[model samples]
Target chain A: MKKHNYSAGPCILPQEVFEKSAQAILNFNNSGLSILEISHRSKDFVAVMDEARALALELLGLEGKGYQALFLHGGASLEFLMIPYNLMKVEGKAAYLDTGTWANSAIKEAKHFGETVVVASSKAENYNHIPKGYVVPSDADYFHCTSNNTIFGTQMKEFPSLEIPMVCDMSSDIFSRTLDFSKFDLIYAGAQKNMGPAGTTLVVVKEEILGKSGRNIPNMLDYVQHIEKESMYNTPAVFPVYASLLTLQWLKNLGGIAAIEKVNEAKANLLYTEIDRNPLFKGAAVAEFRSNMNATFLLNDETHAPIFDKLWKEAGISGLPGHRSVGGYRASMYNALPLESVQVLVDVMKELESKI
Target chain B: MKKHNYSAGPCILPQEVFEKSAQAILNFNNSGLSILEISHRSKDFVAVMDEARALALELLGLEGKGYQALFLHGGASLEFLMIPYNLMKVEGKAAYLDTGTWANSAIKEAKHFGETVVVASSKAENYNHIPKGYVVPSDADYFHCTSNNTIFGTQMKEFPSLEIPMVCDMSSDIFSRTLDFSKFDLIYAGAQKNMGPAGTTLVVVKEEILGKSGRNIPNMLDYVQHIEKESMYNTPAVFPVYASLLTLQWLKNLGGIAAIEKVNEAKANLLYTEIDRNPLFKGAAVAEFRSNMNATFLLNDETHAPIFDKLWKEAGISGLPGHRSVGGYRASMYNALPLESVQVLVDVMKELESKI
Candidate 1:
């Protein structure tokens, strides 16, 4: 059966990128070696390195902006520690917007090193919306927020212009839209979601923001080490970085994030409109803070829960389950999720309505 | 033109495994979802988890030995910090046998948390051999050594008998042969060199090794946290781990370590004999300490180096350059390298002799 992938992370990718990536794994740009087996130091792979880093900057439109793009090992969870380690020298106090699990996780990791203030939390309303109107601690070194919450299906559609160094965890919605990345001092995303695969994390940091941390960070933990080595301080995950490059090229070929954003808005509106029009299902997140990436919803009756699941699975759609923290149904509409896949989910919802 | 892969780690795998890994990447096990897009928590992926872990233990022949095998995200470099964070709580010093660069790196990380003793070091002779006959520190908590030196092509043929824990950085040579694994409390290898790819690391730790260290490790950095979560602590490098599973399964189908060892030794012997017997080239390391996985050799005259490089490039043999540290030639004889390829390298050596 033909299938559509809606997994939140480690999710769907374009067929062109997969074919291109597989070829590289086999022959690596006609160099007659597997990308998996090649040294990141090799000339062929250096081109891959340069391409991956450049494409990230190109996609974000941050050339000549004093921002350095780094591809490093460890997921965003590791970055949770590193961001604090690299930036904590001036961070006597930091304001963290506790939007959901990932933001909370970041806040927890940061507090181990120094003082962190939770300015606003969405947990009171069950994280259905982005926490807003939090008093910005003007004295803090930087303010941190997650741009997109993968599980909760909430997003910070707009960021506060605090003017201080700003950090954003764009794990879910990076490359899904065009934005002024120059406004944020640092931004990172795990590759598993919108980027490429799960092995590497993409970090775009302003060079000046570094060297301010008073702590004696390990060479590996320091962003400057990777920056100096060009992310080749140690052997990198070459294949995943190559895959990221291919995906970025594809995104660029598809007219970059601006073009993708329009299509994304269409897909999200279709799904959201359908959910709002039907009584059998209800949007799990608050309307104003809804995520264009993830559409979380539930059935009118508990009896139809499994039925809805069976309906979608039979229709050749998968990975639409919601989080256990807020269990129901979650249709993750990440970048590269074809509009047809969302239509498939909407069709299932419509079919259930007819049966009722 | 035919090509051979000699780039270490993510190095090379059989063509069959690549084909299979690719199909799964497109859609996993007929589950109607790409392997990349599936949830690590889904039952479909849980089977991948069980198979890869079970195969790792089975390959080591450590069945029912009260040890748990884990597949994790970061490379062995992270383990340099993680190992001490997990096991260094005992105030007693740990013995480090410095074989090469990676070995010393681990030693540097261990010093941050507890007392460490450099029991042995081969750096005096330029890391030409694994150092031996150092007194095992009576107050030591554990003994750590790198199993195989990638750059120098030297390996520890045997481990010193000790009462304390035996920990190893087996990044370059795990599952190369059947070994007395019970001698070690923990062993970790990055997936690039001998495992599958560079995105994941394989760590096997004795279950009882935990809790002895009184240090507080960050949740992600702690081995116990991963063990408790069954290696599903977060979204894993899903495709790499899955690809590694196929490689591990491939290892088993080739009759486990014993069978592969016989073939691997044959490949290494052919290439080394050629390196020593031919006048056009000379071996880099001492014969007794040479690595079976990576064979380092040099041209008899430095003037012919570029010629030899061009000859191999035209012959479709790739990654033949030796490490800058050991400037000559290194023919990595990995498990996936066919005996025929080694013969090709020997043939080139013979041809070089005639040309010179």
Candidate 2:
């Protein structure tokens, strides 16, 4: 049976990416050598690295801009350390919004570098909604926020206009919706979500805002060093970058983020509509701040859990369970997840109501 | 034609690893889902992570010896930074042996942390030989060295006993030959060489050596944190780790390092013997320190370069060009490289001699 996979991350990618990447693994570009065995410096793999970096910038609509895209090895969690190591100055502060787990983790790492200020936090409410009306101090070296919270299924619909360089962790929602991508000085996402697989992180940084930290940075941690090397400052995650390029190419063929956003909206609406209409279910997050990429909801009565679980499992659904913090269900409909898969989950939800 | 790949790091892996990893990408474990799409936290992938970590220690013969193996990101270059952050105290110094490009790179990163002492260096000799008889300060935080220098084709044939933690960057020669695996307190290698691909790095550390640096280490750069998290401290490079696991399994099936070492010695002897006998060709690195993994050689008379290059290319040999600094040919016979490939290269060299 074809599974309706809704894994939050390392999640569903386009089927074509799987087939093509697998083929490359067997024999890359008809080179008679597996992609796994080829030197990253080979003309073939260098072309792959170049195209992947370019395609990522192109998909985000940042082409020809000062923003440079890098496919680095460590995931977004490493970016948490690099961001501070590259941006925060000696005794200088950085402002961060505590939205959820990832956002809070970023803050914890930043504190080790210098003064880290949490401008606002939705944590007190169990991160059920986006915190509003918070002030980001103008003196901050950078303002950081998580664009979407995967664990809580909450996303920031509006970003604050900040004088400082704005950095956002778009790990779960990048390339899902069309936004003013140029507004932020730095944006990063782990490839495991909407981009590709789990080996690389996509970092798009505005070159001008860097090298002002006035602190001596390690070569690997410095953005300038990576940018100068064209993301090949060291050995890159070649397979993941190639797979990400394939995903980005798939998105481009699907008319880019603009076209995909419409389908995503439809999927989110269908699941949220079912959640609201059925008395057996209720949405986990506040409606206004709910993430289109991941819809978190719960059964109104605990007793319906067994039937709902069985129905989804029998329906060939996988990865529909929510995070432990929000004990319910999370239907992650990433870029590659078909609308038909969302329909199947809704049907399962409705069937439970009828049986009751 | 099946080209014999001799590219250095990100070089050839076992053919079975390529096939199995490719299949996993399409559909993992008969689970009706791509390995690229499944959650790292999922039962299947977690098992992969567990087995990969266990297998690394098992292959190194470090199992049950207080060593914790971790698969990390950012390659050995990142370890250049992390080692200083985790092992070098704020006021203390560390000792390093500068052998070649990579060893010098390690020294540069360590200097950023604290006082870095070069115990020995062959840079003056263009790194054609490994430095020996260097004294390591007992008061230093740790003693660092590159076990094998890929760029210069030199390797440390012997290691000195140190009271301090002994850290070695075995990125190129790991698992290719058997050594006293318990000698080093920490061993790190980028998976691109003998292990797997370019995305993940394998770190094996003795538990007692960590957590004594006393610096406020960033969570990502801290080895103790990674060990505690069992290498899933963040989203690990899943594909690279899986592919590495496949390569390690292949090694074990072939009777592990003990069995592979005999083959490696045989392969090295075959090529080096030919280089010494052939009047037209001369070995680049010193015979005593020449690496078994990578053998650098040059044409004795530059006039025959085109013919020799053409001969190798015609024989379905690729990645035979030595690094620019060396200006010759480097036949990297990593573990996955078949002896037949080396025989082909030797035949080509003999063919050049006959043609000349």
Candidate 3:
């Protein structure tokens, strides 16, 4: 049976990337050394780091624009704290939009460093929609928002053009679509979603926005120090970074983010159309705020839940189970997820509907 | 052409561990999903985490001893700061022994959190010997030391029985030998030299020693929080942790630290004996403090450098070059390195001597 991976994170990567990464584990660049054992400072792994950083900026259309890209360990969860630690000052206030779990977590961490104002929140609606028409405080040092909510499957369609610097956590939706790169001062993503593996976090920061925090940032968490050391300030997540480099190469070869966004749109539209048209299920998020990356839905007839789950599982679907906080199905269609997998899911839904 | 890997970290792992890890990256547990794509919360990876933690504690003879083992990201460098952040209070002082590079780095980070006193240092000798007979201040919150200096090639053969808590950085020599586990309140090691890879760090902390800092530690850096979450406080360096698990399994199957220590001693003795007898080479560290993990040596005649280098290269040796701070050869014979590799290196030395 052909397995369809719809895992939320540490999720899906291109098959070629997996194969290449596996081969590298055996012998990296024919160095007769496993990628697992090679030094990050070695010329072979250095090229991997350089290419990964370059490709991230290139895909975001921010190359040579004073934006530095770094692949660091500790996932996005750590970034939640590191961002505020390095960017938020003791007296300054940063504005955050609480869309879902990750954004709320970010806001919580930012509060430890400085005053954090929740500019907008959709918590009242169980985070089923993206908040809009929120006011950004002029006194705020920066306006932070999560571009995509992986749990509730709500995505911000239009970002607010703020006078203050903008920081975005694009963990789930990064590189899945093309966005204006010049708008945000800092952007970070955990690589498990649209990128590669789970270990390394991708941080893209505008160099000019840093050094204004006026606080002593720890060396490992300091953006300026990491940039100065070229992300080799310490031994990075070498295997994950190398896997990310391969994925970026695949993305570049397929014509970068612009080209992938079309496929992503088609995949999301395919499943969402099924959810809307089929009487058995309904979309989790509002139609207007629906995420093209993570399409979440719930069955209309709760009694048929077991049947639907069995249908999908028999069809070789994996990681389609929704988060415990949101009890429903979530099909994460990352950059590596193919249209065929989405069709398989859509077909399973159609089969369940017809049987009913 | 067999390769003799002697790289200091991101260093050699057992060939079987490498093979299994590579296979898992392709299809983990026959689940039709790559280990790279599985969620940390998934049962498979959770098992990996649990087994790794259990095996670490079991090997250390600290199982059920009120200690916690965590596999975290950001390397030992991050732990350098985390140690102080979670242990050092605002007005409290911590005592340290400045042995070499990593220990000094740890001291530097400790100073950021609280008053750090260097109880002893061998900096005057360029760290060629481990300082002995230094009394740790009774007023100090804890006593910290580096068990082995990777760059300086010095190892502390005996640990001080301190009245206060003892913290040791065993990055280069962890699991390579058996030690009295109850003597230290905390031990941290980067998983590159003897353990596994470079990204993940191993932290074993006594539960009772935590919460003494009386400072608000950041969520990610807090030992209590991570312990509560079983080190899944973040997404973790999943790949590295999984690799570390496999390596731990390999170590356990080979009869754990006690068995490996014999092999390590033999390999170190084989190389050190050659370095002493071979006129072409001279050992760098004082014989009393010379490391069994990293054997640092220099050529007797600077003129023979090129020839000696060529001979080693021709014999398929890797990572034998010394750090720039100490201009000599450093053959790091971690647990994974077989005695055969040391014999090959010793043979290369003899060949160079014959040519001379």
Candidate 4:
């Protein structure tokens, strides 16, 4: 059976990345040693680290600048706390955009270290669109926002040009498109989406924003410690980093994010068009705020739900269920998720239409 | 040339474990799909999660017990801060032994939250041995100790029996030997040594010790939160956890930790005997408190150091350099390291001896 994967966070990965990373796992560069068995401080693995960091900088277009691209431990959830710990001073206030689950969680953690002001929030409308007209407080430390809402299926097409520095949680839609690097002071993403496996967290930070916050940050939770050590403070998740390296190489080979962005747009257009035009399916969010990465929708009737689920299962499709917070369907189209998979999903929708 | 990995952590893994994990990286279970491409919430991947947790409990002999084992996202480095955050209450103190770098760091983080007493310390002798306690503090919230010192190469042969609760940072030497679970209220280890890779931290905590800290613990850093969600509160390090699952399976097939302990003992004995008897090499730590996993030593003649390094590198042995604090050589003979590798190191020592 032809299988298509549509999971949200720990979604899909490219084939070449998997093949090469697997080979490295068994015998790294035919070095007669598994990649897992090598020391992180060794010259060979150091090269891997150097190249991965270099590529991340190149991809983000932050090279030759004072910014450091680091691969750190802990996922985006940990970053939810570390971001506030490193940025939010004791007496200062930080501006935040409360979009959905992850955004609100980051806000909650930020409240522990400093006062937080919701500059903008889509919560009033149940997070159906990217909330606009946020007033960035002049007295705030910085402004925080999530680039894409993974569960809510809303994206900020144009970032707010705030007077304060911008900090972004790009965990879901980091490498899917290109952006002006000069706008944001900091950006972070967990590796499960648009990167590689589920271990590493990539952080790209402008050096100027740190050390200003008057919080006594713990060493492990501090960004400056990782910045100084080049992210080798402790033993990192080597395999996941290596897998991410392979994924980056593949991305570069595909002509970088600009190239992939076109394909991604086409995929999103195909699926969203089918959902909007078809009677059996309706788009979940407002038309202006639909996510190019996650196309969410609801079936016309609940009676077709069971048969729809069975047909997809029979066809060997997986992770089509919506998040528990919202009971509908979400087809997550990460970078590694081939357009053919989206086509397969479009075909399923068409087939269902024919049956009716 | 065959490589012999003697890295203390992120060290040798079972050859089959590497192969199986590598296969999953490429085409998981021959599914024509990479494990990285799947959803962590999918049924197949959930089985991997459930089985890994199940096997962890089973391996620790805690399967149906009231205790719970969680796979945390950060390395054991995070536990340095998390331990204090989760345990230290207002007016409460935790007693800790200052043994080595990791132990001191744990103490450092603990002090930030509440009172911490360094009840015993081996710093007087430069961490050559674990400290012998004159007393365990009566009012301690918990007595914390590192089970093994990776840099100093010292293992605790026996833990102090205290009326107060006890927790251990068993980072380097977990699963390398048999542990009496009844004495511990909590145990945590980074999964880089004697397990799998270096992304996930395994935490086994007693339910009674939690919810008493009185600190506003962030959800990501909270052990209770992870326990409640079965470690799926966020997307975990899927590849590392999955790789670790295969390692536990390999351990079970080899008759669990007891069977591997014998092999580990034999390997350690062979290498330590070489260090003791050889005129060129001298053991640094006390013989009685030496670790079976990492045997730290130095050259009898400092002049012969360059030659010693060259010889070992020529022999394709890596990670033999001892820690800078204890400058010499450390041949870490982990559970997966074959006795044949130990013999090969012995042969190198003999060859060096003949030339000198």
Q: How many pairs collide in each candidate, listed in order?
A: 9, 1, 1, 0
lDDT of 3 by residue, A14-129 (tens): 99998999999898888899998877778888988998998899889999898999998788877888888777777888899999999998888877787899988999899999
Off by over 4 Å in 4: A310-316
lDDT of 2 by residue, A59-137 (tens): 8899988999999878999999999989998879999999999999999999999999999998889999999999999
lDDT of 4 by residue, B260-284 (tens): 8899899988999999899998988
TM per prediction: 0.96, 0.99, 0.99, 0.97
Return the lDDT, model 2, position A34.
Answer: 91
Scanning candidate 1 chain A in windows of ten residues, the lowest lDDT window is A25-34
**Rank list by DockQ:** 2, 3, 4, 1
lDDT of 4 at A327: 72
**Runs of candidate 2 exceeding 4 Å displacement:** none
lDDT of 3 at A346: 94
Error of 2 at B242 (Å): 0.5
Candidate 1 residue spans exceeding 4 A from truth: B90-92
TM-score of chain A of each: 0.98, 0.99, 0.99, 0.98
After the best TM-score superposition of candidate 1, give how far the Cα of residue B104 lies from its true spot, in angstroms.
Answer: 2.2
User: Model 1, range A1-356, lDDT digits (tens) per residue?
Assistant: 76777787888887777777767666677766667777777788888888889889988999889999999888899888888878865548777999999999999888877889899998888899997678888878788899998888988888888867999999899999778899999999999888887778999999999988787676677899889999887778777788888888989999999999998999999999999998898989999989999888887687988778889989988788888877888888888888988898899999988887
Q: Give per-residue CA lDDT, model 1, range B232-328, as digits (tens).
A: 7877888788889889988889898899999999999898888878887888888898999999888878998877787777777987778888888
DockQ of predicted candidate 3: 0.77
How many backbone clashes are present in model 1? Answer: 9
lDDT of each: 0.84, 0.93, 0.90, 0.86
